[model samples]
Target chain A: MPMWEESSLVRVVPSARPRKLAKVPFVELADGRLQGVVSSGSDISRVYVSSVAAGDFAFACRTNNNRPCGGLRGGFCNHVTALVGEAVLQYGGARVARYLQAETAEAADAAGTAAVPTAQQLTAAMSAVRPQQSADGQAVTGQVFSRFLRHLAYLELPATTAPLPEMHWFPTAGAVA
Target chain B: MRADLLAAELPDLDEALAAVDAFDEVLAGGLLRPQPAQAAGLNALADAVAGSPIAALVAEAAEKAAAGVAGEEHLVALAAGRTALFGAVHDAVLARVDEATGRPREAAPPFEPGAPLPVNLLASARAWLCDVARAGWRGMDHELAATAAPVVSALLPSAELRRLAVLLDGFAAELAASCPGRTLEQIPLRRWADLWARGMLLTQPGAIAAAGAAAESAAGAASTALTGRLLPLGVDLHEHATGVQAQVHAVFEPADGGPARLVRASVSAPKPDTVVGAGAWQLLRPHLSLLAAAGEGRAMELTGMPVTDEGDLLWSDDRAHVGESADVFTTARVALPAVRSGATAPLDRHPTRIAEPVLVEGYTVDGSGAEVAFVIGGERLAVDTGRVPAASPLTPQAVAGSRACVGLLRWDAGRFRLQPLAVQSAAKSKAAVAQAGAWAGGTSDKNAAKAEKAATDAVTVLRERAGRLLRS
Candidate 1:
């Protein structure tokens, strides 16, 4: 996704007004996890979220504490929420729906059906289930559904988020270079 | 309006304030005989603890930490007193802010930029000399009396030449009150340097900078004298450059100090390139924290990959938005001989390499693609050791716990380009060990005697083993 759009998600999610910044280059890992480098003052930190493409959706940033967004402590913070939102924007609802489905679609998928609910299908199903339940029950259902969706929201689409095979960058010897 | 602006900066204040304990703990822990290199970071931390007041306590705390207390009770009382003093200052900052905004407190006079400035070199020098003498009189450093004597010399007074000198006899006499040697004249450079440093505490920061520049002018006198590129500092060049291998003995917690309102992320290597990052202190904090945690006191090698200075890459992004400039922190205070030669850790363990490193979480660092940290002195550290010159011996297989001098054009703890130099070889060292083993394989009378001794001691060993077995 374009970096400006991603930044706008920063404002949009716990999200505030968007500020133009250097483009945050987010690459899609082969396993469907979306990864990116966010500027950390002369330094850059690695932020990534797992694809429900396989199973559980996970979110992490090297700069973050055990709690998301540097342990603000209340809940998933603006940074994580924004990154996840950017992933959803980049990968499309359908792709995220696939990863989220991978996490909870054990029984039927194990039976060789392999069909997992797409992001749109899940969103529709989540909305569809609300009317049948009480208000509090719907709130709980919405919270759980939103939590799952948030992780998938940041997953890069398989179409654009290709990451190179495993490799790391290190310094070589000689004079400074 | 000022309070409102300061209110907007509360987060930065919070960080500097919060860092009080972490920074104070490190300083207090090493209160005894703290190295000169430890001073800068501690000063930065102290600023956050209580602004200038905590700073006033630093020299005294350093003295107390150095002077052996009679008991732990005394030490605890000394520390508690310092803590209480710091708390008072912290409270004072908040209290003043509230008071200023709430009542009719007179506004602080604004700084007049174009006013006559203190550029009277002679007056400042005399003032500094008198201060040094007074400090000696107060028993701060009696050796300073020797340094003060030369400034008062007839020839020196007539010539008005500011130069390095050695007044060896006066110092010993001043402290001992009965020494054989009288005050001597100007001697050789090295001896002059040694005695000159002995009286360094007597010299003011402005004088030190002047001396540094003067030393630069006398570069032709000494063969090993710092010149064009050999010195740690760059001449007319922007990016800082050099090769130094030293342990990161301590990483001071990020703190704000000085008139510039800049927070400094200063590191001191054995051959340290302490490029103090100032002005944007608040924005520069998180980066300092990482440098504090990851590279502090750890064997790290960095190269100043200056774009012009035969370096490979720039650690800072050329296209990145400029936040702060190196020029802002330039002052006489920055000219202190930051690291004493004695402060550096022995450097025979690490391999030499340089690069503009970022320390990404999952990139392969070593040749073996091992995710393991570089373990040394029982601390696990992650340093980028991946790519190198074909002739370089800094591969992961080669780099271990060796001390590395880091060369850099600049350092803010946020972004710095460092190259490791003077690396001690792991392969050659292991090969030497293997060679020793091979020599052991040869028949030597000492080895034979040792074997015989082992055999003779087998009975005692057996009894100990049997007893252990019985207990089990």
Candidate 2:
């Protein structure tokens, strides 16, 4: 039930399929190191992040142990936080950016010549600057949207950009830097 | 003299012949008369013989006349003739004595005791035949009367035989009435015979064999009925508790050399590894010995096997008497800490006095991912811990940890031992980590020390944490 909160952002892969996504990056904040691996898919994939509540994060971390030590104050350990960061960078954040840019480009071509860009088109145009690689050797364009920064990096975008929906961010002053 | 005498005899002879004819008719009718009549006739004939030489000839002529008569008739004729002769003599005498006699004086004969009487042996024989015939007819009548008496008495409807028939009819009527809507008349005679034989056997030693057979059949029917009733109830109760299809197997046996019976049932259902509690033996402490003894030659048999109220097995052993007093409660408690939520409140509250021997050992997964082997209750069980293949749908953690776990703390061989699943896992993990570190460092000796240190550290951490929790 706790996973329902992130339902809109995450998709559950079919249990039968193995290794649908590749290259998850794990960032260790304690040692300032980044580690990434291309994992073969499994029946259960839980990404633990320190940004989540300590109790919730510990539960995710100890999924392997099967016994969830309930109500731990600061979460299980750093092992889980690194795993979550890697999963987001590899699978979720890059995929969303490419989809937005493609949709905006298609909408622009369909309109008459010298078509003025909408707010969504402007956001998509800025997201086109970041690039990533798909598993099939295809280029994946990243999104530069203000919301993308808030979600993937847990950072607040400057208000100088076009008007965007207000969103509350978890306290992560040290995680992003 | 000649004419008068001759005429007198002639009249006697005529009278005798007529009497003979009448006696013949009575003899032919098969009747017997009294004995006096024929004796007097023989006396007259004798007197006539003495009177004249021609008297013999006259008597002969009289006999010839009576010859046509039967034996009884001849005797009658002779008797009449004797009487007539006497009368004639008296007449003759009176005529001779005319002066003395008034109104024909009668000459009286003197009585003589030794006089010979003519008996006509042939007539007597014929008379005896008629008597014999009459006696036979009388005897037949008596016999018929005797035979009729019992038969008629029986027909009168109050004899024992008749009464029994009536009672049986009444009994049959009552039986029919009791079972209304059934066709009583159609009942087979053999069935009645069988029932009668059964009833007789119960009361009489003569019927013992039949009675025994009936008893055995009845017992079989009762056992089948009991099984049918208990089976469904067991299944329903098992499903209610475990939320799975419960399979039940049962065996019922008549007690061997005992009056009591033995009924055994086993139930199996899928159980979540997380759900744990004391085993069935712990709950049913009072009857453990009996259960163990009863289950001795049977498989999947356990002493004090846990059962629901409906006789569904919650836990069972693969072999009987193997874990007769294995302390299931401690085993379940240690194996599943998730169910307990890691609370050890009960241990301090009810301290168990350890007075027996025990041994302690830890096991873990080898490099090949096969579980470490350990022994409990004299049976070896392995916990499977393996990494999930990358291609597998199951995650690495679920593969490594998903196991049917059990733990035991025992006093054996003069020592106390604790065998817990957590300890097993920790040992396996440490070994694997050491082996990996050794390979990475390219020095087995260095890695061995490192592994020992790591194990020491882990044990120290666990002890400290457990102590703190127990103190709190």
Candidate 3:
């Protein structure tokens, strides 16, 4: 799967203000993406999606409120992660991988001669970078996957989709076709 | 007697007697007629006298006229002369009384002691003592010693008593010489004591003492009250007054609440600026000393020409500017000379570059009192001191602004900081631009741009000069 397509799901709180709540709807995206809003208080909330199938992803979020509040965690919530993951599984990660690789290559070029690795090459490098464990040791793939997900979140990416733009989702096979 | 001559003389005699009665009435009434009318009346009387028998009887009428008694001219002259003589005596007595005590001499109840000494009197005594001390009168006689002792006792109960007493003794001895062969009743001990006190108050010791006490007490009370309400901020309060172009008293009080015991100060001067009266030095002295002890920096004393009436130039002639209507006064700018004491590292030795004299300007409104303004270079520095009386010592704060330039040049090296002292308008900011321009050798411009340019240039020059001095 493409690194960008490898989505994770995490819970979030929703904001309290009427305008903020209106901006974050409870219904799925117009294109059939799964999404839900969560909040710790009326003033603060996080719109998110969570699923066992998808790994966890979260970002700090902010409102127009002048008071100090949390920011969008990696610009995505669990709901967006779930939506992306579902889309990725149905469509396959090849196109998304290509897109992510192109963006990273462009960034590398801008930074002046850092090696621009392909998506497959980057995945291979990640696998190598993971610490080796004993054969009888506990399965460390979950930890490795979590660390990789965090590193991908940290990576600055060019905006592929405009924020709060209309979203579309398709069934896995149909989308791939 | 010839019948015709006798008849003519009789009528003249009657006229003369009538004139005498009129003169007696005028004198008895004690009415002060206008000068011109009085002169005219005397002239008319004198003309009648010249035509009378008295002139005819006198062989040497010209001689009598010269003596101012025989003819009409003589009578007129005598009247004017007598009037002048009486006026002079009155004026002299009034002036003398004002000098002896701190009140108006002509006012009722002259020399009323036991009442609180006028603030100006205390300030003057303090200034006089300082001058005497500076003059090395430490070993002066009883009169001098007496002059400073009581005044010092009044102000500084704990410190410098012995020195002050010696000065007062010398002053008292001098007084003894003035009252030759007179018994104590003729000039009572109380009167003598008051005179001695007045002298000391005019000097440095008395001013220092009164200012020290007033500043210490007031500052203590204020600090105590303020500390409870606000953050524990240390404040030094000073006060002073002036009269007739002399410093009466100046006082300074340091923070008494903290480990720093309040440093009390006072001083007096004959020609203190209107603000921070002559007595201000007494109030300010202790603070200067305290600041010096704290290793704040060195003080610089800078003398400047007072502003003149025509607004033409600054001159050192003290008499030139008085009574002339002008917006600026020639202020004696005292900048505490730079001292190197409290710095962690050795500073670069800088040549002492004297700063340009600062101009203190302000206007006097009839009911509102004197409002003085001070300008240092181009900027209008805040004047934190009180009103300026004719006679008083300048306060350290009054002098602090000009001293700021000195401070900038001389790094505060734990010695004493030079601060600007001024006798200027209380409205420090508004008229400062004009003052600065005047100081920088430019006529006050009505145009904003020109005035601003002049101010900028003056400031730049001052800063550059200060910096160069510091570097050197």
Candidate 4:
């Protein structure tokens, strides 16, 4: 028997509440960008595919038809905000913060007391200091939407205990290897 | 289709079993090639059951299955196809195919002349288990032997059932050996009893249906919103012949003045070598942040959590958020007094289950700490150290006059014993009040440096053992 190390035991700290992200259905950290698909609020038929580069905060939000979002003027739009929030919800706030290179220092609240910054707060802190940047997210938008559509397809599957050929990679408990 | 009509259409048991084996072999091969689409065995099976209602669906399913893996989102497509296929076969074909006793079912006689008709074997197994839990295995050795007699006698004797009987007999002998003052073997007696119980349950007439129902309930059942303070007790790792299982034990005190429940999150790896190199804690890094919060004894909120029948929390799609940190000292002081004395009773909900979680507080360590017993209200409960091979024995110096301890109460060596997971101690000075996290030396991060060194030492021991083996 060996004693466990202190680093392995992580002590958690309180952070801010996550922003609502129901508009965004898919979010992922991949290809050096935080990218996802966000459905349009007003137009039920439309969706916004968005991306933000890891280090530079370079962002893009365009519809599936290559139409650019009007909310990308000086900073991140609501779609991008929803994307980051959902990304935080899916991955931990710490992991998402690290991926986006967002600073995680404790920010002072209105009462002048120290408060632990969440992923959203960290991202906001980074955006406040850096100059606005943009990127062409046209190529990755199609890939993200395609993946989202595939995710939706899982719902169509009928309920059964039979082993799926593709699910062989995911082991179930009590399964005989 | 009607049962009589379907039975007429069905192939003999041998043919059906052969077909199923062939299909299973193909599945086991996974994505590998060399086998052709639409295997001959599958076609033959379809032809043999052509008169059945689902023969066409079976053929279609077989063809789609034989086709090689698909593009992105292959899992969804494959699942839909497999579900439809299995549903058709199960409802129409396999339902009538009696693989166990075969068609024209054997008229096996009852073990006793006046044995209960349509015997509830599962209920019998459950009652027997409840008795064994109340009394130690040795106390119930006679009942354990007698319980197996009828199930074996009533069932049509097959090689499989005979082997099960032999297994039950072996367990009885082992339990009898665990008499007072006897050196007990390391074998997990409770687990063996659990296995025997499940085997006995399956020997009944409606066993398959009962099993299916149990599985369905386990998969779908979720508890309502659970708000509580969770204290991370410790982590335990065990290496089995097939793989490794690591568990995180904790005590969850519900906010609404409900009884405390022991929460356990376990991760298993069928292939150990792939995950074991980095150490068990590293393997569980994904849950590290949450566990670390609980390690400090944090107030948390959980929703739609799926708990095992035995009450250990299962980590599947459940999400928990850490809130304000709780003072572990005050919490333990308040919580310890609420727990009732004696071994934690077995849950009647799950009959064939083992693993009863318990927390024992305010126990003074007896003299000669090398082999220790917790003296609680004049009752001596020995600490079972065999389960935690890596943990150091509880020394008087470690406790430092604090009596708070939490662990699982289990039957071991002909009696019940406490396997301590976490312990607490008080500070010598009043200026610095002993924080729960600091006193959690039993499982706290303060032991990290020592843990790393121990891991290195373990590797060296393994190398030396290997060298000795080679020399031999």
Best by DockQ: 1
Predictions in order: lDDT: 0.26, 0.24, 0.24, 0.42
Candidate 4 lDDT at B134 equals: 29
Off by over 4 Å in 3: A1-177, B1-167, B176-193, B196-264, B267-287, B290-421, B424-472
Q: Rank the candidates by TM-score, best first.
A: 4, 1, 3, 2
Write down the worst ten-residue block by lDDT for model 1 chain A: A160-169
Residue A76 error for model 4, in Å? Answer: 69
Q: Write the per-residue lDDT of candidate 4 for residues A44-82, one digit (tens) a residue.
A: 557788888766778888886768888888788888888
Report the Cα interface RMSD of each model, rounded to 1 decimal: 30.4, 41.0, 43.8, 22.3
What is candidate 1's lDDT per residue for A45-95, written digit by digit as tens? 322221211223343343321112353232333443444454445444434
Writing each residue's lDDT as its tens digit, candidate 4 over B1-472 gives 1112222444453454344334333332332231563355345545544666656655664454455432212222222222333333333232332321122222222222211224454345334433333243324333344454344333212222322232333333333323221222233332333333333333333332222233345556644334566655554444321123445555567767787655555543322121122233333434334444544556556554444433345454345666677644454455533432111112111211123334456567775665567777666666644344222333334443446655544332223445555556544542222222221123543554465444444334333322332223
lDDT of 3 by residue, B20-70 (tens): 333322222112222343334333344445543443322243234323334
Residue B308 error, candidate 1, Å: 18
Off by over 4 Å in 1: A1-177, B1-227, B230-395, B401-424, B429-472
**lDDT rank, highest first?**
4, 1, 3, 2
B120 Cα displacement, candidate 4 (Å): 25
Residue B461 of model 3 has an lDDT of: 33
Indicate the worst ten consecutive residues by lDDT in candidate 2 chain B: B231-240
- Categorize the docking of model 3: incorrect
TM-score of each: 0.19, 0.14, 0.16, 0.34
The TM-score of the first chain in every model comes to: 0.33, 0.20, 0.21, 0.68
